[model samples]
Target: MLMFSEDKGKVKFNKPLYGMTGKYTLAEGISLPYFSSLLDIDRAINELRIAEQVPASLEAKWSLKELFQREIDEKRVRQDIVKGYLLDPKKLKFFNAITIVLMPKGADDKILDSFENDSTIPPPTIPWEGNDVEDGQWNHPNARIANFGGVQFISIGLSARLRWDENRVLAVAVDGQHRLSALRTFREDQEFGRSGSLRTHEQETKIPVLFVLLHPDAGFLNVSVQANYSIRRISRELFTDLNKNAKTVDKARELILDDKSINAQCVRTLLTESTTEDIPGLLPLSLVRWQDDFNRFDTSYYLNSLVHLNLLVSEILELKDKELRDPMDKKQVMGFIKSINDALGINGQEVKDGERPLTRYYLEDCCEDEEDPHTPFSRLPEHYLDSAVEGFIVNFRPWLLRLLLDFKPYQELLAYARQYNLIEGNFGKFQAQTSKHKNAILQQENTKDSEWNKREILIPQSAINSMKENQWAFKAIFQKAMIRLGRIIGFEVRSENKNLGNIDDFLNFLNGLYDKGILRVDASLPDHSYRLWTFIALNPGNEKIKVNRAVEDRIFSLLRLWYFGTRKIQIDTAAGEQILSNRKLLQFFAADKNRVHWPGCPEAYETLRKGFDVATLYRKDSNEITIEEKKELVRVRFSAVLAAGLPVLSQLQRGALHEQSSEYYNQDNES
Candidate 1:
């Protein structure tokens, strides 16, 4: 086995990158443990032709039968959607082969040198709302993909440290990259102006990242990493020299079935190992990590970090007192982390296997790199999280889950491998992306790690729109608002009654308060007006005055509804789980400290005075909300800045205002 110290540096690889550890075909003077450098990554990649072509030349020319098979396969492929136009027997000669003319020296030399200093080549993403383009270059003129990350241009680069024994050449920008060709087409177009922007120029506006070659190769070489124009996964020879140093998911694994606890008989009884409470002793479990079998490399530095999490858990739980048994505090640690999601809240997310109280869709991002044998998550102490009762982690579960869980509403994440699969399932090219990975998900950790680690986060088109519309603002404003409100409402309100159905019911309760004499002030109007009252309370212009009847009904109703009927989610995190009341979050805005008469026109409150006079319904049909109404609601949901001031409107408030025109009725009718 290649020891840690001798491995040079990290070289990424797809699972099972090369054959076995020792199996590799290096033509002529090709070396093993070749290190990559700034000047060599691209060179090493293009050099594969020498290793492969030289070996292929020695093989006898294809026999008649072999040639016939190749002909048939080509014919069959020619009729498919991807190649029907190219494989027509007429184009076959021109299809598999490309004519190459040596560019008289100095061609593109300037462009090549410019890229040398800038290794990070952020190629243009296809804008979803691609506008018009000339010659079909910038905007994906070909309606092939759905969005950015779908473009098929290959990224040939190197990992350079010590060039001789630790070099790596990666041919990436594959699969998911081409999926967004459609979107990249529009965003890169300088012509995509406001005059007629597709969806008003909502996508990223970046210059198309054209590939540059500083050291240009003149001979015709096959381009084979995922591309619409290339033969998929078909290289005449496997990448051997490049594969030896690549690392894929590779780790130890054990099925920890200790019926006798016999395997652990030697464990020290004096250990009082709290970390292994559920296991009762150090448990035997399969340890796995993604291997670079596809390109070929591995590592142990990843393994050390994993062990640290276990040690941390053990140290925290090793208190001498018997009462402090399990490190339940781990839950507290977990809670401190945020949900890794940028989409809507995870209310409907489900689990395929056992149930974890908080198996959120956002948490799915944490295990994205499970494909890499050395993927950080694959090494996490998950076995500890395996059982329902007090169980020690398997190894590296917590650290990985915590890292992802810490970034709530995914901060425009880049890709991680395992997540790419889940994401593909929802959108993009999910068909077959998973490829029987579930059973393999846990079983082949060492096999899939490299692919999992390379994925970057694909930001949602909708979120990009929000940022664009808000001048680069994010929805985190709501999160801060939620946090602020959650802290101020005493977290729990006391009520004499329960059974409130929803926010609407809470509003009705406040209305009920006004019907009874318990609420003072403007009792001239009947039914609670919780929406209007709360707005008045929170509105900066409206200060805390004596309890007015207009607000009394709503306040009483809100108190009754939240104190007794409100339900809360038990947010589980590494810091442990806590039952949080959302009602408290609403109260912060309505608190007395916020009531004032400074920010806006106080005249807005006088709109309520018209309610007593305008109590009669002039038009009864205007109040109805239909399916069409709901459709419009959906589009406006993200843009609708939760209007809560006297001028603002909540869903409940809108529903209530739509019911009866309080402004039309006359006060004399009741007396």
Candidate 2:
């Protein structure tokens, strides 16, 4: 066991720990030799009375000494560090040398003997020198001594002080006591094997220690605290990957150096330089739970979510076919960033950091009174049209592409209808907030101009222009299209209770729908039963059965006019704020639990294509007929068509049930 020398002021060693060893002075009164070796740390555990705490009820004489009397559980030390080391000796290479502070009980001048020059061994290399060295500086050079001791005591830098006479503790461990205890336990065969004698013939292991001598001075106690607590250590995350130089900062630097994309560059800029008054990376950094060492060149406190953000951006740029969008070059991606920033009202003048993007930008001031039809979301709330943006795109992109693929003929037909007023509704007045003249239609001389000045054409300019001119029209059109699509296939999307009002209320309602499995829009098709619209695209290879793109666009345009322009159903009203009490009118399109169908049922579409005017089913003006009178007319005209498809639907439902039964029986037999 390592212990104090016979002199009590110096550290004693039975044999040389490493090939070279000597003693040297550090600062004015401290000095010790430093070397690296395997240490039996278990033999060096020391508990010293370091501090005290007194309760309010006790007198002031209780003193502060009781604070340091708290004992460390040695078993915890063995389990955490020692057992792992014995199992794999390779783990022993990481710990620094143990520190021992020796305070001789009485004033011992002989302790300074080691601080003096030793003629027997070569002089030690001290780390620091000159007047810069203060008394408390741990790395200060050793002061020269006048006496020469026969025994060689080498001090490279590690040292401890000893307090004699006052306490028989003799020596105290300032650091690494757990390591010492674990070493002791392993040595005593309390670890590794059942018999514990498997490693009895092991080679001698030595631990390098620094020894300092002090004469029980108050200054020495302060020095012990300073020695143990002052030095800053690397973070655990950085320390584990030290061999590969893998640190948070390093990863950030790599992204800046290799990835020159605008988004990546923005991330780099946020980490490296403060572009705004506040730290640009603060919000992102706050989300990070780990960081690299402070001394690392690329030590970033904030780049933890950089990877997730980049991945999201990448996905947003992909085409419906899962291919990289040909139009999404660097310039296009930058444009998208600017557009998103504009939509969120995030001015690029200052990059806000350390905030949740969704909460800060999207959810602010969105919820409002549903009774008011004047308000609209500040940004285009397309995501609110569906619960999941990914699912929304998946369902709509194919449908949209099929429509846009042959849009020229559809546009001409719309132009013809507008010019002649042949459609059911009049597009003669403007009800949008953007327009000054309430009664005049906003006519664009350059009708083909791009809406946002971006070079992309996913949908027709005429359609986009109409929607932008009146956002209320867009919401009405979107619902009509959804209902029409649902009718063509046999699925019903809207529920009576789920009818919500306005954009914000609808967003909340969609969230509820998602929870109730009503709007379970996910990527997996086989697991989803609500995606009846997808079946149109899944039609078997028969070209005759497949719906044509021009036909689809015509139907979509027809429904938009039939609902928004003719029926004049305000966005909030259709959203379910004030329930449309026309149950007879709704039953003509929307399906109940038993019979599933929507507005654009194929038979209904055939009826409309044969030049049937939908305005004939409902009252256009109160002067002509009352709501109840129109409801009677609608019920009479659509009762037969509503019941016509029941036989086909029943046949399909029966076949599906039989297939499900067969699959379950097969699985049960196999099990």
Candidate 3:
């Protein structure tokens, strides 16, 4: 509907002379099919989506002027600076075109000459201030990390150069287009010693992209059934609430039917009477599909499964007792599930990611077609663990994911995962790559709004040693929250490894430092802070998890702040007191003592001891979890290292500097 340049000219392309280029493809061939209607359009779009067949013979002379609102003040009185920025392409440098020899599917060498004669005066470079470095420097870590391995680029041909009002815009390849465009444009322009704008700057930037060519009417970034990116905008609080619906449902399930509830005996008869397994809260989260089908799985399905899974698991723990851990860890269960499934080989897709597990981070990587069993998912009991459900969790995920190519469902699933605290590979590692790593497809092109949705990941306590020594009091105060959130273990994080590696890697040293008031780790605010953050991103909510980063930064910052070699007090507090302060010291003591919030009433604790209806909510399952609070709090009071293990820490610190040389023994990537 919108177009800027409609110029039609007799622009004659140079002849394909064998003498001029040593290659001869004079055989005339026509190859352009604008797919029409429902089926044919889909087919045509599908074929052209991947293929780049711009033949010399089929030269449709497009002399249309590549137009733009050159001067910002022209025609449209773009007084609203925000609107101008959101719609500005010249400012964003999102415009790019790939000129490549299009290779046919499964074909090599004999690539069809695509974009052979498509060169125009204005090159397809992202116009950043017409010449600024920041234009291409947008951080899209979730986008393709690299295409064809190392090169952060992708294949994009001249599909369609549609017009938007006064701007020339691209219309196809929604995902990875930015990255591809950046690469193509950078590769096209390079001078000696002078780095031709190959990469973008560091800080993340976002521009509102309007779909001008794809759907002329599609003005906003509306999500489609095909390639959805961001989920509908939900507040961070609401997102957490929506995700925690499972918890609410789970609570209702227990209250209505659990033996500990008021209707202990008669609730079963009142509910289903079928062993009371179909309680509301009990649900397996795997029912959620990876595709945006109308029949999307909800918390209801998850609740249903939990009703049964909980009943079975609770009974199993009572029966198998000690084997089942105090904390219901997925990794342990996954190992158990895999041991049973080792015999029955998984069908469908098999990615050769050598060491990683075969589950989606959500565990839907192997989801299968819904099967009607004798009972609902909530009523299946633990028998499924030895039967089809076991096979489904272990085998079906990979099978189902192979076919769901539509990117939206995956995005939604990931969005949901981040909304809730369910990170870890339940579905498979592929899900992690898809949802968290954000490095799947690297380049500015592959960037999306969902990429920024991950607010932060909670930092693990094991890595707390990496945070600066000045922050120890802070870290100590926050250790309780970290342990509760699985970010830390009270005394030891790496129980087996002990002090075998770098002093930093050793949980004892990490804990000792914290106890000695050296590392200052940030404490998560509340549900509001953790709302949209997944474990992939370590913000304030995950500062503890990225303690290594904090530590690394502190060491370097010290070097810059003070001339090096002058201070021998790497662990000493007096010399390094420039950064630390009395206010933080007070906060540390307050946090360490669990006095951040006034401990007015012991109602929750007393209620638990008295065994009230919601007693379990505030109760600690074990002493190991409860008794270590004081130890962790008092331990991190900072003190200078007396030079015992300084040499080893220095070496480990150096290795960390080189992006390798980890404390973990024999890690493949350790420098």
**Candidate that would win on TM-score:** 2
- Model 1 Cα RMSD, 1 decimal: 27.8
Cα lDDT computed for each candidate against the true fold: 0.23, 0.31, 0.25
Q: How far is candidate 3 from the true structure (C-alpha RMSD, Å)?
A: 28.8
| Candidate 3 local distance difference test against the native | 0.25
After superposing candidate 1 on the true structure, give the runs of residues whose Cα lies further than 4 Å from its correct spot: 1-435, 439-484, 489-671
lDDT tens digits, residue span 306-327, model 2: 4433332233223222221422
Candidate 2 deviant stretches above 4 angstroms: 1-70, 88-93, 105-169, 189-191, 194-204, 215-671
lDDT of 3 by residue, 196-256 (tens): 3223341133222212111112111223322332111111222234334534433334534
Select the stronger candidate by lDDT from 2 and 3: 2
Measured by lDDT, the strongest candidate is: 2
What's the TM for model 2?
0.25
TM-score, model 1 to reference:
0.18
TM-score of each: 0.18, 0.25, 0.16
Steric collisions counted per model: 139, 48, 69
lDDT of 1 by residue, 320-374 (tens): 3233232233332233222211011133232112454323322443333422111
